[model samples]
Target: MTKTGTRNRINAGAWLISPPAFFAVALLAVPLAAVVLISFWTQTGIRDFDTALTTANYREALSDPLYLQLMMRSVWVSAAVTLVTVVLAFPIAYYVSFHVSPRRKPLWIFLITIPFWTSYLIRVFLWKVILGYSGVLNTGLQWLGIIDDPLTVILYNVNAVVITLAHAYAPFAILPIFVALEKIDRPLLEAARDLGEGVVQTFRRVTLPLAMPGVIAASLIVFIPTVGDYITPRLVGGPGGLMIANMIQTQFLRLNNAPMGAALAVQAMGIVAVLALVFVLVLRKLTRRLAQ
Candidate 1:
């Protein structure tokens, strides 16, 4: 196209994108700016707070050993959820993508998303019922004579949080991997086979490499929000399962420390950002090495 035509098209594109851009800025950027600003203010009492700027919130959060441990545990739990969810999701996505008929793919995808129709809170509570001491799992095990008594290890801990989060986020992981798998050139695998590469070898060198983007995306989807998840940790996590989000909630609600809560939120965001950045860099390097 001519320069004038191209410029006009560019202008039109910008106009089309402007609405979502403005919405994002108004909703996300503005609220985030407010949060950062509030994090520096001083909380004077339960109902009263001052606009006086201070770094004491950050100092206090970083200095506290309990907060530090909770942050670390949150990161660890998120990582575990990402890992387990992706691993479970990959096979299902692969099956649906490669084995299912194209005409039926939509049905399979619809089934995968059926869980989303329910309230997330309800789903977490459902997990509590399923994993509770006298819940479905324990009852079933006892009926089968697999256990002499109801297992106390099933709920109210980090393990329960991880299991519930993994199940909750499984759909998020599957869709991305399915999309990535769908984009793979079938001829690449045929070429590998013709060159005498075994099934496992072809998958390792061809399929897995090409699909890394989706896997990374799936991991990020599970990890980022799971790190901030307070409800699951609150409902089923109990004492040892408590994460950074729970601590942040305690500050805002129970402790009545809004400034400190805001500070904790900011620190959590920073930690998540740093973790995402490191994952991207490491994945990029790995992709390059594999390419070479």
Candidate 2:
């Protein structure tokens, strides 16, 4: 093609993407830029902000022990939720993708996503009822003579937050894994078996490596949003389960310190970005080593 024709094609492609590009900038980029900009400003009074740029918010957000504790709690809670969701999801995804009949796979996937049909708040409340001292789980276990007293550890704490978040995000974790497992060529598994590998060995050498991409994807999907999750932590998390997001909420609303909240939010985003990057890099490296 002539340079003019190539240029026309490129221009046409740009024109086609311009609408979505504009929306992305308007909806995502602009808001994010506004938050970052606000993070550098000073809160002088309730409903009052100094437009002059300052770093005090960032310094306090990072250095304050309470803020640091909440930040770390958010990180670990998110990590725990990610681990549980992915681990449980992998088996379900594997079973549906590898063992279930292809004709029935869609039905199984649909069933797995039934949890999403309900409102998220409703689901969290349902979990609260199930995990409460006098809740279904405790009552059932008591009836079965498994425990004489109600369990207090499972509700209104970090455990509750993890359980609720894990359950909420389970479908997100499962779909990616199921897709990855589906894409695995059955012939490859057969090849591994023919080479005298056992079930565990074949999976370790072949299936797990191929499925790492999905696992990584699922981890990121669960980890990123859960860190910023405020609702679940609020409803079921109690005082102990309150995360950095709760503090951020307080800063923005109750405390009337939007700048500090923005700084905290930016810091949280930075931490999540760094951790996610490290996670992907490490997982990819492990996958390469496993493949080799």
- The model with the greatest lDDT is 2
Q: Write the per-residue lDDT of candidate 2 for residues 1-292, one digit (tens) a residue.
A: 9999999999999999999999999999999999999999998988788999999999998799999999999999999999999999999999999889989998998899899899999999999999999999999999999999999999999999999999999999999999999999999999999999999988988999999989999999999999999999999999999999999999998989998999999999999999999999999999988877
Q: Residues 1-292, candidate 1, lDDT per residue (tens digit)?
A: 9999999999999999999999999999999999899899998887888998999999998999999999999999999999999999999999998899999999999999999999999999999999999999999999999999888776999999999999999999999999999999999999999999898888887888888899899989999999999999999999999999998899898999888999999999999999999998898788667645
Stretches off by above 4 angstroms in model 1 are 1-4, 290-292
Each candidate's lDDT (Cα)? Answer: 0.94, 0.96
TM-score of each: 0.95, 0.98
- Native-vs-model 1 lDDT? 0.94
Q: For model 1, which pairs clash?
A: none
Rate residue 182 of model 1 by lDDT.
Answer: 97
